[model samples]
Target: MAVKLNTPIKLVLFDVDGVMTDGTIYMAESGEFCKAFNVKDGLAIELLRAHEIKSGVISGKASPALTNRCQKLGFDIIETGCKHKLPKLEQICTNFNVTADAIAFCGDDVLDLPIMERCGLSVAPADAHQLVLEQADWVSAYKGGSGMVRDFVDTLLLSQSNIGLKEIYQPLLRKIALDDLTGVEQ
Candidate 1:
């Protein structure tokens, strides 16, 4: 069954490696690490914040970069180094004063299954593992860290007819070429 995006969504939870960084862990020669994040996804998160939707990140790995990124994104909850995610999910729900029916959880790996099953809506990236894709209520056409989160944000905002987003994006839409407007290159 398709999860409806028109409803008021209270919380949005994301998985770090795959959903935020294309699932790659890059280590430099000097042991400094880095991960690529999509600018569009960053902007989408900001939009979600503007609409008063609470956002968070839950990652199995603990990295300084991830922490820094989460801080920069203004995420309300950051759960890192969590191998088992169910407890973290429960804690976040309690902390937010929301139920499973009001939250959306996006994940891309088997480790994210338990929470995904419990969320109101479950999302997966296009390149997510088979199990995760199967469990997701929606699988984004765009891959993680490559505009998948942006796609999800757009879907939610458009489906809800969010006035703020409409006011911002509608003007830009009019300026784009028709092919670009449809996101299809001719």
Candidate 2:
């Protein structure tokens, strides 16, 4: 049997360390925290926004760098240092007034299981742990922080032909009627 994303997701949730940052942490001599992020994933977030999909970041550990990155990305929800994610998931659901079935979550480890189990669509990176890969409804071909989110975003957007992504672009195109088109051609 094959598993697929049956319903279109309105919200996208991601884990920070593995899904967005390649699961690596670098501590400088001065104790500054840093993580490497893939540019492709950042573009994926832009694509999601183009299609009017809400997005957020949920991480077990907190980092100022991660917070700034998410803010710059325009993610709607930012939950950091959350060891217990289920409650946070509930809070998101409530805030968005969206059902669990309209959410997609991509995770790479054990801590992500509970919410993944409850979400309508669950994804894991190719390099995720054995247990997480086994439980995932969809395992991405790309590894974490290496275009995994891009792969998922592409798949999700491709699956929505009827929704017409062109329509999403039209509004911005109109604004560019020789005016607010500062970044329209992009």
lDDT of each: 0.83, 0.85
**Alpha-carbon TM-score of each model against the true structure:** 0.84, 0.87
lDDT for model 1, please: 0.83
Which residue segments of model 1 deviate by more than 4 Å?
1-7, 162-165, 168-186
lDDT of 1 by residue, 1-186 (tens): 234853478899999888977888899898877888888898778778766788999889888888989898889999999999999888887877898878889999999999999988899999999999999989999898889898888777666664665675654454345648679532
Tens-place lDDT per residue, model 2, 1-186, is 133666879999999888987899999998888988998898788778867899998899898888888988879899999988999999999999998889999999999999999999888999998888988988888889999998888777767655555664454455546454465443
Candidate 2, poorest ten consecutive residues by summed lDDT: 177-186
Assess the local accuracy of residue 182 in candidate 1 as a C-alpha lDDT between 0 and 100: 77
Q: Which has the greatest TM-score?
A: 2
